[model samples]
Target: MIIENFSSEKRENKLNQLSAEFVVAGGGIAGVCAAITAARKGVKTILIQDRPVLGGNASSEVRLWVLGATSHMGNNNRWSREGGVMDEILIENLYKNREGNAVIFDTILLDKVMQEENITLMLNTAVSAVQKADEKSIEAVWAFNSQNSTHYKIDAPLFCDATGDGLVAFQAGAPFRIGAEAKEEFGELFAPDEAYGHLLGHSMYFYSKKTDEPVKYKAPSYALKEIEKIPRFRVIRKEHKGCNFWWFEYGGRRDTIHETEEIKYELWKVIYGVWDYIKNSGNFEDVDNMTLEWVGNVPGKRESRRFEGLYMMKQQDVIGQTEFEDAVAHGGWALDLHPADGVYSELSGCTQWHSKGVYHIPYRSFVSKGIDNLLLAGRIISASHVAFGSTRVMATCGVGAQAVGMAAAVCKELGVQPADLMEVTNLKKLQNELNLTGQSIPNIPIRPESNLLTQARVTASSALTLSTIPFDGKWKKLNVSSAQLLPFEANTAYAFKVQVNASEKTTLEVQLRKSHNDKNYSPEVILESQVIEVGAGEQTVDFKFESSVADQQYAFVTFMANPALEIKCSEKRITGVLSVFNGENDKVSNKGKQTPPQGIGVDEFEFWIPERRPEGENIAMEISPAIEAFDVSNIGNGFVRPWGTANAWVADLSDTKPTLKMEWDSEQPLSEIRLFLDTDYDHALESVQFGHPEEVIPFCLQNYTIKDLNGQVLFQQSDNYQTINAFKFEEGFSTKGLLIETEHPSSDVPAAIFEVVCL
Candidate 1:
């Protein structure tokens, strides 16, 4: 043997090197969405994924359901579904994979990436080495492709750690924290008193099918020995399979990363033993034909490592519905947190509390605080343990990913890092851009510089004006009891006015009701009914109510019903002012308590009709305007809340041909026009896990035609789809004004423009 104990030549390992503008790690929903957004904007993007297929937990291997603002039908999440890419993905699944097949879902995700020409997808590749230029920036990443046994050296100017565990951030020396933070650290009510290195845990689920013949089962050696030791195992049924048993989770108290394989083994035992109980325990009802079709080999994880960012979400932010100026996303899920012991815990599966509505998520939560070149999305973003319980869902994470991707593209254009996005002026520009892409940021208004409606004077055929806000003073049909909402600032004087028309002689009683508590939606406090006598035709009443409303309070002016009284319907949609406690035929279910379908329909299209009339058609009552003439600032003052009732100008429904007309003081550069047609934004976009609803919306504008002032037809569309209508021309024309003639299926309904945006 030679003294040196080595060959003269040193071994050299060959590696494949590639360059890109942006490199995203992980192929989960967040990574997939981020890569898609950047690639579509012409960013040279590289997506490295450890799995063979896309969609981390949502893939066929893990079989976890894709849940977001809908919260899987819990938490009274009406109109809370996510928009943008998430909306497209859910609609696609409903159309293509109606049966909820996981295999077909994988193809749908793959198809999305393939459609983007600029995205370089490398699957079955695990990132192993991180090369840093200095202490602050990551220069390159080396990932080994397991499928082909090749090492890839990927170099990019900017990087996104969308991996759920924050792998790239950890390896790049980025500042981050693992496990839980102490209650005092963030002042989070849901946080633990003492900080612990524990996680929310990993979960696995199984699927079952029915068979004609009885199926037999043999327990594997690693199967859980004691059936009595497992919790929530009796829930297995013939119709019950995936997502129904998210409680079948474990491995939280142990190291979720280093011990992942061991945790997977433990989950398998629990899954098989649970199925055995359903099949052979003899306590089951009709299970002779029931058999396990598939069991997840890989456990789906909920939480792992969270990286530090400019802002960390706290429990107070969620419970208080804190408004952030730089908000880019929202979450409506309840403050859901689990015991660290997971399935083995003696306590219940989880503790949950709902909020008033959706809470805002600021843009500051997307970038790294210390690192210049790194950004993060997905479950690994900066947030307290309790806050993550709500934001960790796939739909919410996808929105954060979209924000990060767009920010990356903007950074490239501006020649800056992720930190520069926090500038006040730049943040507003980003918000404006996001609104254009159909992302909703509650309470934020579109700036006037780009808002076309703000620059043009608008006039409608007829608008049933009420208060400064639309729909707050409207009353309508089968007046079992109608309520008008009064929004007032503290210490400000408010005049409550009511105009009533009586078909037959009846008395109108008005009650100012106050909200009881958080749990119940009932406005129980009757602040004394101010009654008034009304004759046939019309009568007006005015009252100066007691000034006790605190800041941001909404008082319901409840008007007790009189069968003899009928309010005429207004052509313009009045949003929420047409609140009726109950119709003569409306009844609740006999079983569980049901929040009556939010929009206009459940079994019938009742939402389209605001109020019921005893002898005639349903219509909204006309409210005298604060100003005599229509204002240009009326439509696009920017707030599009109250869902269906945003400030809209109504065209004359009775005119031979009703048209929406806009005029400007000077020639305005107009290439594109967007119309916010009236559709039920109050109702949600369903996943179709339940039965599908009516495919066509009756209240929305059905057909429309557009042309210049000269009457030359520019564009036209029929069999119109969706609540938001857009018309675009590449070769734009300079014009002072354009006429929009909308055709409706029914003369009773006219085109109501909530926001008419042009560019």
Candidate 2:
């Protein structure tokens, strides 16, 4: 290498011009999912992220757990975990990184994006300028990378702004809102006043580890010296670490976008001050050996600029559970909002209100109002400040962004603007495309005509008859009210016998309950109540319910809290069956029931949640005149997940070699076969910090084989953990009949499948 001589000239980085069919800004979960989905749809796409890694707030730099519809199973959204590309990412994370290391998660996101050949990923690159083809549409975008000293100009027909702050949309002259609206604006009763808070704040977290030797920490002169200034200082405990301190926030009243760095500095001072108290203050236990392992330099921003779109989601759309005609995605995280003062305020950290069921988000919310070629993703989507509280969660944003990505493909195919896809016929096509990929749009089932499996005569080896749930000698304490959610048909009578051990003579209060909305799992409709007197020892209690409903629904056989009794639990785990407890999950809900203030425009409901794996065992009980709901014909029912019913065909527990056969009238050429398996959608797969108990969902089929008419094996797989297992033949084969043999995940859990598609 040779030294260069100084010259009297200005130096500029090399400029590069590139073009793609679709362009996505921001490398957060939303943008990553959008770019991946678009690429998979055969669209040439470019993903640009300013950060060094993907996942935005969910990245290692700012580690926030990824949560969505299930809301950590803290509410009544049964089987409501998001599906599609987002689901694949979460499942892969669980399979390889169950420990939930944020850094490991980063690699997983990168790996997923790399797997798609149509995608070009650019990391550590920020979009600096927006070029408009006209006053209403985006023509291209300009980005710069300091690390490489390069500038890029990317042109595209369509653009998606998933940059969290709506940078692209903002620069393109798209309309956006920065603060909360008054109650009169959208008729949102939960709308906060100006003094309470208009926007959610930014938060920073730190990780600490215990060392063999004592470690000392010294606060800098700039670090906050007075810890008592924070109103909720007493909430800090020696055990509190990482995301547990999500309330360590500030800068909601200030400009969230431009003042981000200033807010981050304030958060650092607060974190250092809290650590200084933990190490030096006399209010804690033995923390002498505890040392700071990692502290986030970047703050996780919650609220920023929310852009305007074709339609703006409002408060009623969430709480009322409105079903949109052009529904593309769903969200169920509580309508959670923080005060303007953040950590400094005395308000109870956040005010949360949950819906009885998941609500639909329309496609119109993703298209920019005035910008023709621009699309909105992530927290920047068109939504009122009231609705943004729930839609702002990462997983919800991811699923919605998936819709945007898919819409881009449809737009390109039709050669139309985003708004054109909103037409009834075009919208249905878009929805069908999304459903084909397993995206869950609430209240919308797959269309039967599209699936070749629907044309075949379906038959199974055996079907499960709900006769009894055998006890495994394990007793579950009735310290919290528990219930068994059983699906029942209309005009059916069911009798159950439960075994319970009582510490003393007590009255066991049992109630039969169901949701007012048959599709929801909230136990709001109490059909009947029975009180049984128990002796001082183990005994059996018999109860019966005669249903007189018009439609099939899940009934909650609830046993109210009685500390003196312990109910028997079954080791057998089955598809579409779960045991729930009315309890508190501090992560989402503080109390078992949500009793919002009267005018808040939110419903009051009790949270019946299931425990995670190795703990969420069903209550053991015997039912008279067995219920037969898992029929082989369910495989072509069009619904993939539990919707009002199991919507799955489960084989008998004794049938070790479970098989499903499909026969056609004539020989047909099959090129590809897709199977949708059960993945315990109830389990919230948080991407980081919260580790899962198991790698694979217990209900998934671990091993499976597919054969032609003469029992000759065509395809087989082992160690499968994903929900969608697909097989394709390079050269298609003609078959009169098809057979699928599957092995159960374990002996106790029966094999189950939702839907099968042949192409």
TM-score of each: 0.78, 0.98
Candidate 1 local accuracy as lDDT? Answer: 0.68
Per-residue CA lDDT of model 1 for 1-759, tens digit only, reads 646567789855557999999999999989988898888668899999999999999888887767666554343333456655665565566557656678877898899998999999999999998999889999999999867878999999999999888889999987787788888887775677899988888999888988999878877777876777866554456577766677777888988878889889988988888777777778888888888898988889988888889899988777667889879888876566777777777776776555545778988888887888999999989888888878898878887788888888888878888888789878887787666555667656667778776778766545533443322224454346655543323444455555667886767776766443321123455655677777787766565556444433444556676877755434333332334343222111111122333431111111111122222122232222232122223476664433322345555445556577778898887778877655444333333233234444445666777877778777886876455567776675778877887765465454555567787
Query: For model 2, what is the C-alpha lDDT against the true structure?
Result: 0.91
| Best by the lDDT measure | 2
Best TM-score among the predictions, by candidate number: 2
lDDT for position 57 in model 2: 95
**How many clashing pairs per prediction, in order?**
9, 0
Model 1 bad stretches (over 4 Å): 1-16, 76-78, 92-104, 234-236, 461-634, 640-658, 676-691, 694-703, 718-727, 743-754
